[model samples]
Target: MSDPSRHPPTQAALGILFLILATAFFAVLDTSVKYVGAFVPVLMAVWFRYMFHAVVVTAVMLPLRGRSLLRTAHPRFQVLRGSLLLAVSAISFVALQYMPVGEFTAIVMITPLVVTLLAALFLRERVSALRWVLVTGGFAGALLVVQPGGNVIGWASLLPLVMVFTYAWFQILTSKMARTEDPMTMHFYTGWVGALLSSLVLPVVWKTIPDAGTFAILCLIGLMGTVGHFLLILAFKRTQASTLTPYLYGQIGFAMFCGWLVFGHVPGQLELIGIAMIVLCGATASWLTARDRRLPVEPPEA
Candidate 1:
């Protein structure tokens, strides 16, 4: 009977736990995308992922929110947001083709840095000097993680950097739109826009049709990925960003384990150090962002 809008204190505390669970399963989706990419064009793999996502979202929305899930006030903003997500997903799937999941994921941790900078430049938000310092440190950390030109596992490790930067811009847009939009409107558009956009060019890009087993794998990817984002959005709505930010590091472990178990991809010394720096920067930036958000709040009234 409790309104989810005013989440209980304990519910806020559980946000990170839910985020960690979502991240773990989400990592599996990423690994599966890479697995399918091996047998099909990355674009084709992305196409199927979104189609499955569309089917799942469409079916669920009918029973849950019905026509509300089909409504949104701002179509243009939704289009841009959906486009950004599709780009990030496509870039990431392509990047994973030759990159180890651990290395790809570590580079992705720096996306917060990119988001911080974008927030300052485009959204005109104030970012303290200390946060800038952390962002710079994060850049250096990413270089360490990639260790370019070395006899690394594969030079493709840096490809996810493309996704990170795109995602940074995407997050900034989301932040700006968050004030004007309801979460339901935002969520529905995400699935619908991305699915429709991909479906357009999918016929041109799709090379191989999936087998029955591979089709099932694609379905899993779609369901898990959509569920992961839904859980993430729910978690953030329930708690302070600072409260859940630190737990995203748990994603690294899950990503690495998936790589190890499924692909035998293990990190070498330099990559591990890079992962550490990425972790440090991620934690620091998250702490700073959270602290800033909480600073303007007045004490609760009696």
Candidate 2:
């Protein structure tokens, strides 16, 4: 990885651009998953996502990295990391089925706050008072988005909260493994682990495609996910994660746009305010985290 301190300002600018594009792609992936969920079993859709991602990544990366692409210093941790992500994806797919993309996204955006709580509790990390305030404020924002009596209320609303927890753990494990593992290798295992594990239950969830259009959309989901992560890797290579952290909130805006464009769904006033609060608090918390450690923070993949 190139040191962010050594990079020219133009490189950081390019990294920001890449990160924004990557977020857009993720928004598209979420929208596509929501659309396809209506026509297919959620499990089947999840399988296609990982299957396509695993195959495409293997095809492109194997030749470039050779057997080294499959090498890993911590095989068990890699599997555990991949399983956590699969849980995240499964929760996301099911949650999107019951909730609007924009609101669901805002709730999942509380991941950094959850990560902070987990680190302080389980990792024995010290938490400053200000960081605790940011974490509380971030969750408060999430409550505004999923407030009682809203359309998203009921058991469905808890789905994204569950996703936030699962994804936070995923981010934590990735940060630990990144210290010694090749990122590309970890990426490879993640895809295959998700694909292979999901495949075990595919026999029951398998269903005939209703049409070519549905099939195409499935392919689009895979393409968006694979390309989005690839761009993220490229972006981090060009600039420091702290330099790019603020821009990560761009996904919330993109998700709102996608929800409105596809479903004519717009967030209510409180929901919008809630979303803004999440963006503000989450970004500030990330900045503080990077500042305290003086190391590149591993970003949330969702």
Candidate 3:
């Protein structure tokens, strides 16, 4: 007889669809950030994003989980993780001011590659030679996307690289925390931590919204970010990370579409090739990871 307590097999297709929707929401969030970046101070824009995120999560989650919503075994690590992610968002917004969204996201996608290296170094995970080769190719792809000799090369181009490294560490912390914390609890802390930290600096950088339209856009930024992250959590719950990791590359397509539709920018040939390399390498690395865990691996198209 089937054990009623055992969880059912993961719904891979549903997970992929959730991930795609998450990506679309993220793309819209970025578009909103880039749009508001023109009118608001970067710090203020970031503050509103997090402040509203905290408010929304609290309103929804606190009622459901009550005091348990604030429970965490490692509070310091949670704060640091949220702070690092805040930094990534702030830096990315600044970079978006000067770069196209698609290219910036392509660069940020290197976080997976960096995470592989960090896992080997810090987590002491066994990485095979083939995976190492894939990581190396991912770096090459990043270089192609950056193109030091090309016009796209500038200080702004470096911001996403910084964000990626910080994000890699953030992911490591998240991996650790996921072992002991409820996803909703973690999400709650992320929003509050970011909101609280940014509030500390708001006194020096506050900017008033000049109109209702801009205020509405600011709210949209928070709504999209909160919803996107929630969808991502839901996606992971439905499938193995390895099964879902490859579909993350789908973000590139969504980002590209949003960039062109909003800004009339299309990636150049070299940039497109670089994106392909990064996606392929990252997907392979994720597959190897799943295989190491003895989980069933699926193709990118699957």
| Highest lDDT scorer | 2
Order by TM-score, highest first = 2, 3, 1
Best by TM-score: 2
lDDT of 2 by residue, 1-302 (tens): 66876999999999989899998998998988899998989888889889988999999999999999988889999999999999999888998898888888888878888889999999998888988999999999998998866676588888889889889888888888889999899889999999999999999999998999999998998889888999898898898777888888888889999999998999989998999899888889887766665334544444
Better of 1 and 3 by TM-score: 3
- Report lDDT (Cα) of residue 291, candidate 1: 61
How many clashes would you count in candidate 3?
0
Which scores higher on TM-score, 2 or 3? 2
RMSD of each: 5.3, 1.4, 4.0
By TM-score, how accurate is candidate 1?
0.88
lDDT over C-alpha atoms for residue 95 of model 3: 79
Residue 115 in model 1: shift from native, Å? 1.3
Candidate 1: tens digits of C-alpha lDDT, residues 70-166? 6666789999988888888888888777677777787887877877887788778888898888888888888887777765445465667778878
Model 1 global lDDT (CA atoms, 0 to 1): 0.74
Model 2 residue runs over 4 Å out of place are 294-302
Model 3 pairs in collision:
none
